[model samples]
Target: MSAALVWFRRDLRDHDHAALYHALKAHTQVYCAFVFDRAILDALPSRRDRRVEFIHASLIELDAALRARGGGLIVRHADAREAIPPLALELGASAVYANHDYEPAALARDDAVRGALGAAGLAFHTFKDQVIFEKSEVLTGAGKPFSVFTPYRNAWRKALTPFHLKAYPVERYAAHLAAPPAASIPSLAELGFAPSNLAELKLPCGMRGARQLFDDFRQRIADYGRARDFPAVKGVSYLSIHLRFGTISIRELARFAQEQANEGAEVWLNELIWRDFYQQVLWYRPDVVTQSFRSEYDAVQWEEGEAAERLFAAWCEARTGYPIVDAAMRQLNQTGWMHNRLRMVVASFLTKDLGIHWLRGERYFADTLNDYDLAANNGGWQWAASTGCDAQPWFRIFNPVTQSQRFDAQGRFIRRYLPELADLPDKLIHEPWLMSAIDQSAYRCTLGRDYPKPIVDHAAARERTLARFKAVRPTGD
Candidate 1:
């Protein structure tokens, strides 16, 4: 081909990028472009979106990197499906390349783009870049998609090879990069978004940011296994947003994990594998986006009507009366992120204790989380609700107090987010309702006064949840 266009979607980096590498290697003149799709941006619930701000900052870096290497990014704010083909035609490119996006909506968008490209006598090529293994790359002995995580993890590990971990060597074909026509990258305001707390949260953006986070985490990976569960501790890598945006290469991180022999690295590697596992699940069963993975569990009725609305609002607004749950929700509300362990705790409390539908909580997370990945979020919510493949057993519901007492033993995380309960003794912090009037007054915290009472009795809620699931439980294996 004389010329080719590379469309940047989730894969934003210049180096080790599959589509970019292919475009540069295959053609004499290569152009790169990213469209801030209106179809997506116009539907966002808020103007001050951290995700958009992060992307804007990242694009500025990406444009700089590309410019330094004899290429530049072409930016546009339009419907991508309506823009990509015409942009390719206007550039007189023979082909358009992009990394695969497995989300159903993305797949549909890509399909539309492909049809348009084909009609214009142009080729559209996509490669697996975001994930290590995709589609049927890893499967069960019966040639079926592995629904359970353990066996899938084992299979994913066994299937690993050096080739899968190797970079695409994009710099090798830097000669093919064509300089862009004069045009500057768009500002966040120009793109119809306001700046969010992403910078105040100290989250670096783009390739440099990803590198910063990975380097810091490399030093702490050895301790991840033991310390990751405590929300008060900085035990986990904050590279999730980086990974979500493709600012870092999956191959690079997985290779680093594979080289490390420590238990913490092993656990972290397992998390990466889980990421791949969820991606594959999303690919094979896009229906999981709307329905339960195990359909039988769908029969279990969730809380409804005004009472359900009140409970859900309490959960979202961080006044659930459970210190840990409220604290977790508060963290999510204030920061665009939540601790991994707290995600499970709060999700369990919403679905099990309050009996609200998982989708309600799932949609809330989708809106708020900076790393709001559909596959992982849906998989997690379903797991919490005991409605997913290899999910937590319905009867084995989480007791909010016990989880709080264990995970936040000193109530450090709780106090950080719920300052009203800051003076409560650690023993009583997890359950302030247990404090007597004198103790509550002495602590400067009064139940239903300083803080709301527990929204639902854990024991009672647990029994009700068990009964709900039991009604739909398939008899005998």
Candidate 2:
């Protein structure tokens, strides 16, 4: 009987998994394995990374799930390129199956693994599972990848069929799941990582965790459109981390959104479409990871030297003296999660207000965010910087105070993250430094001592930003 090995990557769950289902159907014996690739782990800056902890927890659940199905995952802790081929040889597997990973580094790694497996007389097969439509599956009428989002989203919707959203029934071939020798899933310490605040934050992990979050989100999804923008409110799915790790399937989320048919569901579905859009963008233009999508924008000058370093440090530490910006940064530092509106606000503040390079912020987010997907994070930073496809106009700078006033009008979100400014009235909460000395005394909030004064004048920064971006503007206007 033929044997196949299913290498688990981002798609971690057992159900509705494309590679697993395909392997089960085609091979008489199907084996599952996961590699804690050192190539990725060793590059991480922190040993207390939440993503690593979350993955560790998810893998435990995955192992248990596979065991219940009369099989167990072969866990490894080597570079995937070296680990996968040898494992296939040891198992005498004829094929190695896995889901697609579109990032350039991952693509290169997959190519190497494929080559090694081919040389060893094993077929390497990959399926599109992480996204609903990937890699030119939904393209423009001219058969080119669409750079614009709205049209691409429209095309994605048009191309959607029942078959596209259908779940793979791996259980139909459960008999083929081979019972492998028991292996212990590694702990955080075993992986040379320390415990993170992920447990304290109480964000769920694994398929069970994904289900819990989705069940809660389903009830509130009808209000998502209006409530999602407010950081104080519980409106968003909180499933982004799940999506990034593939603990939950995209098809499951999209199908639910479509069936709901409310304004909130539709808006949320639009978000899923945006995820697809960014994926395809990365697939088509890999250079965007480092360079601006529009080459002209690369000419824009950013702040540098000691002053720029100080500004970035302030932004990272939530001491920029702008309540919303500080609050957002603090949220990221404390929880590894930031509200979507605040993400845009802080990104614009970084690239436009501070005159810092977007790549710097992108790298910071990649290091910090629990849901950090390279394409989405890069696309978002570049979009905020007005250097990406279909980006916001450079002239449209976000006013931090106004954004705070609008989104967190009552100062609920700001107070949650920046308690130093909590006693300030709503009028001054968005701009705590604006309060008079007498008012500050009355509120028990001192600008320099309790919090900080605005690092730079907003009006002055606006003019400087306008001038800075003008250098990269198209010749005519």
Candidate 3:
């Protein structure tokens, strides 16, 4: 009987899975596997990374789900390029199946795996699972990949059909899910990692967790448009980590949003489209992984040496003295997640306000965020830095104080993360440094000692950032 091996990567779910569906349909017997690829893991600076913990937890659920369906995930801790070929050979499989990964390194690894599998006379099949549309699927009238989001979003909506939102019914061929010998999944200690505060954070893991968050979000989705901007309010869908790890299918989420057809639903659906747009950007311009998308902006100089390092360190540790930015950083440090509005606010503050490079901020986010994806993270940092295609204009800089007063208007979100400012009035919470010595003593928090003083003067930084961008910006830009 012909056999197939299904390789699970970011997409961890059992139902509505594209590769598993195709593999089970074409082969009489099929086995599933997941690799804790060392190539990716070894380079991580922290073994206690929450993302690793989250993935490990999700995999346990994935394994149990597959076991119920007469199959089990063959978990491994080797380089995927080396592990997959031998596993396929051992299982006597004629083919290997997986979902697409658009990151440059991932693409390179896939190419190597394909070559190895081809040499062994086995087929390596991949399908689009994580995204609704991939690569150049949704392009312009001239067949060029879209660099701007709005036009791309319009074209994406125009091209959407029921076919695109359809889920792959993997259960239909579950009879072909061949049972494998019981393989032990390595513990966190065995994998050279330590425990994290994931459980304490109460982040749901695996398919079940994703569903729980989704169900809650659906109820408040009508208010999502207005409430999402307010960090203290639970207005946003906390499904990003699930989406990043593929515990939930994009098709499922997009379909629900499309069906809702409310104002909030439309706005939420646009965010998903933005995700697809960023993925396509990465596919078309792989150089964006290391360099700016708009090449000319590469010449823009960023602050460096001792002063910049101090500023960056302050930013990372949530001691930047800007309440909103500090609270956002603290939230990420503590929970491995941050509010979407705060993400923009912090990124803008990092690049435009601090006169620091966007790549620095991007790297920090990549290292810190639990839901970090290369495409979206890179796109966001570039947009804030004004160095990407169709990015925010260079002249526009975010005022961190204004953002704090606007979003965390009552400073409730700020006070949640910055307890030292809890006693300060809402009017002064956004700018504690402006408070008089008597007021600071009354509040029992002193700037530069208890919390921190504003790192940079916003107006001065704004002028400097404008001049810095103008140095590299093309004529008439």
Tell me each candidate's TM-score. Answer: 0.99, 0.99, 0.99
Candidate no. 3 TM-score: 0.99
Expressed as tens digits, the lDDT of each residue in 315-387 for candidate 1 is: 9999999999999999998888999999999999999999999999999999999989999999999999999
- Collision pairs in model 2: none
Q: Candidate 3 residues 17-98, lDDT tens each?
A: 9999999999999999999999989989899999999999999999999999999889999999999999999999999999
Query: How does model 2 score by TM-score?
Result: 0.99
What lDDT, from 0 to 1, does candidate 2 have? 0.93
Off by over 4 Å in 2: none
**Segments of candidate 1 deviating more than 4 angstroms:** none
Clashes of 1: 0
What's the residue-level lDDT of 6 in candidate 1? Answer: 96
Q: How far in Å is the alpha carbon of 309 misplaced in model 3?
A: 0.5
Q: After superposition on all CA atoms, what RMSD does each candidate show versus the true structure?
A: 0.9, 0.9, 0.7
Per-residue lDDT value at 274 in model 1: 90
Report the Cα lDDT for candidate 1: 0.93
Q: Could you tally the backbone clashes for each prediction?
A: 0, 0, 0
Residue 414 accuracy (lDDT) in model 1: 93
